[model samples]
Target: MTLAGTLRPQYDCVVVGAGVLGLFTAHHLAQRLDPRRILVLDRGYLSAGASGRNGGGVRQQWEATATIRLAREAVAVYRRFPREFGYNPWFRQGGYLFLAFSEEEAGRLRKVSGVVRSEGLPVRWLEPHAIQRRVPALSTEGLVGATYLSSDGVIFPFPVLWGLYQDLRRRGVEVRTRTEVLGLSREGPQWSVGTSRGTVRTARVLNAAGGWSRDLSALAGLAVPNTPTRHEILATEPVKPFLDPMVVTLRRGLYLSQSMRGEIIGGFSLEHPGEGTSTMPSSSLFLREMSAQMARLFPPLASLRVLRSWAGFYDETPDGFPILGEDPRAPGFFHGNGFGGHGFMLAPAAAPRLASLLLGERTDLDDRLFGPGRFLGTKAARPVEGLTLG
Candidate 1:
């Protein structure tokens, strides 16, 4: 690794975006190559995007086999973080409980239970009474059944970001914040990345721009099938610990869990899709609908004061899976932007695999399902179902 000597005309690799995915990828790149040759650029503060604002629920309750595999590996990486990186991310293994209010949802959970169990993950189908047994405070009056994955839980996203950022800085990785990529062009075999700050030349460039990924792809003269939608979350004032596991209701498109400080932090899906960049207050409709649903789910928290609320956009792909791996036409370029809503949970594990691919090392994991070319006539190997909105 060498020192940053002004803005060089060439670099081994240039990673766009300094979010969790970008920093982790840059860290892995630094590990495999000279850190001096790697430059990480972001348009905003570290983890300022969805990576930081999202409710950090880490679980393997995915419908698709591929997503389940990725999540399985990701949660393992998150669990081992304290020992592996000497940073306690505060991962709570309180588990995740998916409550199904309607019979249709319950049936779906039954099928998903088979899928996860087939993968050797400890997901079991539970009756409403069983759901009550796990989290007594939950209102299961209308619920038919639920799915419980005892190993699933939550972690603090900022701590994880700090840990990874420290590693990148120690490895001499140059991270430029508030530096947005203005444009990108392919000059023969190398890529030229023009940024709001300055121009960067690198042999390879990775797009991990989160919500702005599509625009970045267009800037690079490529078409990426992705959309950014706004998701909102609100935290209530601290109260005595009541619920134990993270509760999710697919039929209602709501998820809730208690933070370490005993504040109930959660959110629900909105029908209106959000577009463009705007961190405005959560809509009145969200406040009304989400609050109503939260009250129904946990009647005990009906009196909890709403502390505050904010919204962030998620880079959702066509099939609800991320577009990973190198682009065929855009040579020496890669996509790690679309994790839908699962980017943070998938970061710790996805980084090492992406690094191996960039370093030309062998990997057993098949990232082809997440390739950009999949939208270009390639049939996706897996499909998404079940209640997943993290």
Candidate 2:
């Protein structure tokens, strides 16, 4: 609702960061708890995080089973979002086409495809000629093979955020923007949270602070190894719809998709000169690298003019998996961060699971998989997810 300036004396749960994950988790929590007892605090206005800066690509072709399951669930939710949330996010299921440059990448896709098929999804392996015919403009010179899944798609992110925010407000959840969390301390079974506005007491607190999540954890005497990497993206001038599926190049992490409005939106990664910092500003190095890669893949893109460009942080971890579940050290505290660049896509599905964990309800996404304690202890060499793209 309004950017609430004052803080309530007490709350059942306080969710930090009003980004996509925070809003979605609060939405789920409101469904079970007294809506007024939950509060979402953010340091900036809505659409200020990676949720707004992303290319809006959603896919299920991931290396890990947990990640693929979460993405599959998100696609299903988006398919029914209009009926569930009364908002049309333009969930276009045009499909996602991933191009492989080497046999190593091709074999990885082949293996990951089996995991996806085991999850009951029809992921197809396509030859270079087939991929060329599917997208006539793409020049598949070094393309060894590709993967196609028609069910995986993209959505306009703003509608998802607005719809969730409005629906949460309708259910009486208090959302306070421009309210930054300053300090966190445990007072024996209760939490005393200090904020820029005022102090509030809440037994339960969920850190979905995104790129700043690790910093927030340290406030509560926890040292998380999450690092921030600045990534950039660009949008090309509108052209007649010529592409269908979102095209992805595994080599450079280059991905391009046409928006419903006809703009070619995409993102890519270059050598990071200064990563692990939270400052976000579009860089010339990124623009030069992205333009060259886009032109090399699809020569037609060479003529397209750049409309805009921007940057955001991907809160990455050593192993490329999101840190979820509650912290054992802090009894009532929980974490929903370390999602890297794909947080927006995973928000809808992961939020409900995180809410379940916060309420001590059993969920399929258990602590063993995504718990904040995953990186700790002698058994920390867990399975690593390798399909992390910027």
Candidate 3:
């Protein structure tokens, strides 16, 4: 909380990464502690990572009870984001329509529907005709069935970052972009975080670095079970508004939605795993596959010229869930990574709880549901979250 230096010699809590998850956690941390005591450091500028390059689909249908619960809260948070964060992310609750092209995927959706319904959210099992009724532009060629939750939504991802960044700055939370963490050494009860700027001491540290999380953990002399996979998305030139809900095909692992600006922004799953380096590269293979799938799904968009394309990394876990909370291997170091491609949606609900944990408060999810230690030994073979599009 010192005002004398450009980079302070000490902080009460130092958050690694300035992405949505990092900023959101710092925002909550500022609420309970002196904002001056919190420091947010990122190697790149805001929205330079996955936070900037995602199709903002927010849905509550998840395979795990914890994920569904978190997603349910995320929808509510986004609904009131403008009032809460002083910026409008243009969140639209037009619902999320998940289609199943095969009976295998159909069965998966049925199970997910049951799990979602059990969590106090209503989901409708729709036949192909019903799916067509929702978005008539969609072609039901290999469609089996689908599930729909009218409350599910999508948002503008950039403003969510700007809103949180603006709010954090206003609250005196120092978010230092282009300041990368070089090393993490245990200094008795505190952490000596060596950054590109300077070394700072902190009683607690949260690794919310997303894609670079595994590398960050290694800096602290700990091994984390998370992988970085590059996924690409494309935005077509604006057209007249047609699509209402975010449409996703389970068998194809592709999702698409119309932005408020009328550009159809969409992305699909690809397999490009990384080894702790920061590189986001777009691919012609992605364009070929996603474009072909998008046009085939909606015959009307067959001739729609693509305006631009980009890539981002999903910090994946073997089980498709995020690893949160402190690690046993390192005493004071904590983790907030491995949310994969869905962190933007889940961060709203998760950040506050993680901040509370950082401030030495016991929260409900500070346990095994998202714990960093959950992947130890026999627990490593956890159940995978099936509703994942990527």
Off by over 4 Å in 1: 1-6, 278-280, 378-382, 385-387
Task: Please give the ranking of all candidate structures by TM-score, highest first, separated by commas.
Answer: 2, 3, 1
Q: For this target, which candidate reaches the highest TM-score against the unseen true structure? A: 2
Off by over 4 Å in 3: 1-5, 273-276, 379-381
| RMSD of every prediction | 2.4, 1.3, 2.0
- What candidate 2 gets wrong by more than 4 Å, as runs, is 273-278
The TM-scores, one per candidate, come to 0.94, 0.97, 0.96
Residue 211 lDDT (model 1):
84
The 10 consecutive residues of candidate 3 with the worst lDDT sum are 270-279
Which of 1 and 2 is the better model by TM-score? 2
Task: Kindly provide the TM-score of model 2 when superposed on the true structure, using C-alpha atoms.
Answer: 0.97
C-alpha lDDT (0 to 100) for residue 40 of candidate 3 = 91
Write candidate 2's Cα lDDT for 1-390 as tens digits: 566457789999999998899999999999899999999998888888888788888999898989998999899888998888999999998889988899999998899899989989999999989988889999989899898999988889998888989998899999988888999999998999999989999989999999889899999999998887788899999999989899988887888899998999998876576665557888888888889898998898898899999988888888888888889888998999999878978888999999999898888875666878877887655788788873
Show pairs that collide, candidate 2: none
Write down the RMSD of candidate 2 (Cα, Å): 1.3
Backbone clashes per model, in order? 0, 0, 0
